[model samples]
Target: MFDWLQHIADWLVYDVFNLSTEQHLANALNFFIYDTVKILILLFVIIFFMGIVNSYFPVDKVKNYLSRHKLYGLEYLMASLFGVVTPFCSCSSVPLFIGFVRGGIPLGVTFAFLITSPLVNEVAIGLFIGLFGLKTTLIYIVSGILLGTISGVILQHLKLERYLTPWVKDVLAQAQREQHLFEAEQLAFKQRLPIIWAEVKKILKGVIPYVVLGIAVGGLMHGYIPEGFFEKYMSKDNLFAVPVATILSVPMYSNASGILPVVQVLVSKGIPLGTAIAFMMGVVGLSLPEAMLLKKVMSLKLIAVFFGIVTLCIIISGYVFNVIL
Candidate 1:
């Protein structure tokens, strides 16, 4: 189906361009071209469909339903499950988080959605199933859900509502007053198409730069870095490997699909499965970009607490996987 893309990539790198296939620079550039194209295609298609689905669930109704439910556990679970289908990265999910807050959903429930959205995307799940088989994929998905749910429950118990930026409360208050003013009509298919396109464009503009930069770094590491480095530091025998991997992943930003190629390399090079998976989760679950976007709505203290809880859970999950798998 994408034979033309493959041919164009090959021609650009090796035939028309006359670059040597064996050179490190050529290989890196080729990988960059190929992966960038494929990922962008996936991103556009996924975002468009997600936009269409979201159009059906108006913010006011979502807020009304979620807010009315006092069952914290069920609410968290529902949020996490919704996160799986939406499959947005943390930065991109920020807008959705704002909407959730505007709808008057509990802070903890919003956190659950934010926490799971990036980690449990459909693309990541599909890729994992292809690479590691169903059993391991199930393990990863279940662990992600549990992590989001538990962390959310803890944060809820902390009662950190005041930690939201004042602007969020102001917006929520405004939204509340406006809720009774107009009932949202179901969007016609034609109307939904424009909304989907707009969403795709907006998300692409925000995410492409991060995706490109991340791929460049990963490409360099893939082509230039020696495999022995990971073997020495992240091997199963290294007691600190899990925590170390988790810590290292926090600053780097990449989607799960974007980072899986690097994770595959790490695992193949004798890095423990648990450590490699931890690193991937760290990138997907938390990053500097996500933090920056979140700063618009969350105080520094709340952000710190959120990351701390998530980090602890990921570390524990890594250890458990290492022991069992």
Candidate 2:
């Protein structure tokens, strides 16, 4: 399957178009533009619909009901599902985390939402589905949710609640007052278009730079990175490769959409699927930016612990996949 896809991609780039270096660069730029546009469109559409749902649905009531339940498994499932639907980035997630904590949700459960929301977002999922097959995409999504839930539960059990910043606790106290407020006059769907567009513009402004950077890195890897490099260091036969890849990817941040092409190159060149997937997961979910953002609400100890746990989980996942497939 991978070989077939690679053949097609190769044909598209080299045979049909006969692209030169300049043309390859142009193609790279075109890919960046295409990816950015697609992500922006998906973000706007999903968030706009989320806004409409927020306006009409009784979220508070639902949250209140869910908060009464103490089943950690169920809570994790719900939190993961919530993540799939919420249109939030890592930075934006702090506010929602604050709200969840203030609303009396367990810290572990909140973490589940925080981790999965940005890492396994709809736009990322859509891109993965398009680039990889359905099986790999589904596995990625399920793994993200499961990781979030298990991590959350483990944190809760560790009693790390004391590691939260004092300010975070204080902020949680105001959750009751931070209710959503909509205009008294309800706007029709047609009227909502402009409002949604403005919100979309705001989101695009924040994401465009990161998207560009991700694409630039991807383009370089696609066109110039040596196939032998991956084979030597990241091959399935290399026992240390999984952990090494996981560690190396932690400081970087890029979603599957941006990384899939790079993963394709790696897999084509003999990198292990598990190692590559683990690297991608680490990059997407346990990034430097996420750690910095989390610092605002957590102590150094908490952040270190969170990172350690997720990194361990990713390594295990990689090894597991390696053994199974």
Candidate 3:
């Protein structure tokens, strides 16, 4: 499927630019061209398709359903799965997190959505399939869902709702949802196209920079980093690799799509798949910026607890993946 892209890369690098395949610059440029174009194409198609799905199943519905139902712990899984369709990064998921809080959904269920929304989404899924193939992508999706669900359940048991700001408490007391927003949406498919297309464009605009930047960095690593450079620290044999990778990722922030190319490069550079994936998860799901955003609604202790729990889960997942893959 991507052979044509390879041909273009070869032609541009070898035939047009007249650079040898052996040259580092040629390799980097080729990787950059192929990955950037491929990822963007996949991202566009997936986002547009998911936008249609999202139009039919709005966030309001998810909120209402979860709020109204008693799913015997299945609700956390449902919320995490919903995150897959949302295509939000950790930062972008904040407003929806606020919405879930205001909707009176249990804080744990909300945490499930917030945790997975950024870590695994349609955008990242499309990119993952292109970058990592099906087997790895399947593992990633399942791991992401499990991470969110487990984290949500753990946090729920802690009863962190008490740590919510007084503002959220007041809002809960006077809760009023704008259900009217979707009340008149019986439009034809064609009628919804423009709105969906606009959203597709907006999302693409918001995400393109990160994708390109990540691929650029990946391209450099693919071309210039010595094989086994990353293995020195993150190899499977390294006992501290997974936790170190997870901890190191907290300060960095990027969406899954944006960080995936780098993750691919890490795998290629001899880093264990689990460690590399954990690092990606950490960066996407647990950034400090996300903490600052949560501070408006959550106390410092709650934020710390949330981050701590997710971090531990991610680290454990890293080890599991290492053993499995």
TM-score of 1: 0.68
Q: Tell me the tens digit of each residue's lDDT in model 2 across 1-325.
A: 1244445545666566677645656455444444444444554555455445544543465466766765648887789779877755543454466446544567888888877776687778887777767888888788888888888888878889899987656543322222233334555666656654564455446445644565455445444444234335677677899988888776454555566677777777778788888887776677665565566568999989988888898898888777765
Please list the residue runs of candidate 3 whose C-alpha ends up more than 4 Å from where it truly belongs after superposition.
1-69, 176-232
Query: What is the lDDT, from 0 to 100, of the residue 126 in candidate 2?
Result: 83
lDDT against the true structure, each candidate: 0.74, 0.65, 0.78
Ranking by lDDT: 3, 1, 2
lDDT of 3 by residue, 1-325 (tens): 5689989988998999999989989988997787678766766776666556555666456667866777888989999999999886675676567656655568998999999999988878899999878998999999999999999999999999999988667544432221232337567778778766775576567556656665676567557754434345677678999998888776665678878988888888788889999989988998765676576678999999999999999999999998898
Q: If scored against the real structure, what TM-score would every candidate get?
A: 0.68, 0.63, 0.64
The model with the greater lDDT, 1 or 2, is: 1
Model 1 agreement with the true structure over 144-196: per-residue lDDT tens digits: 99888888888888999999888667655544433332225544677557645
Return the number of clashes found in candidate 1: 0
| Model 1 CA deviation exceeding 4 Å by range | 1-72, 180-232
Q: Show pairs that collide, candidate 2.
A: none
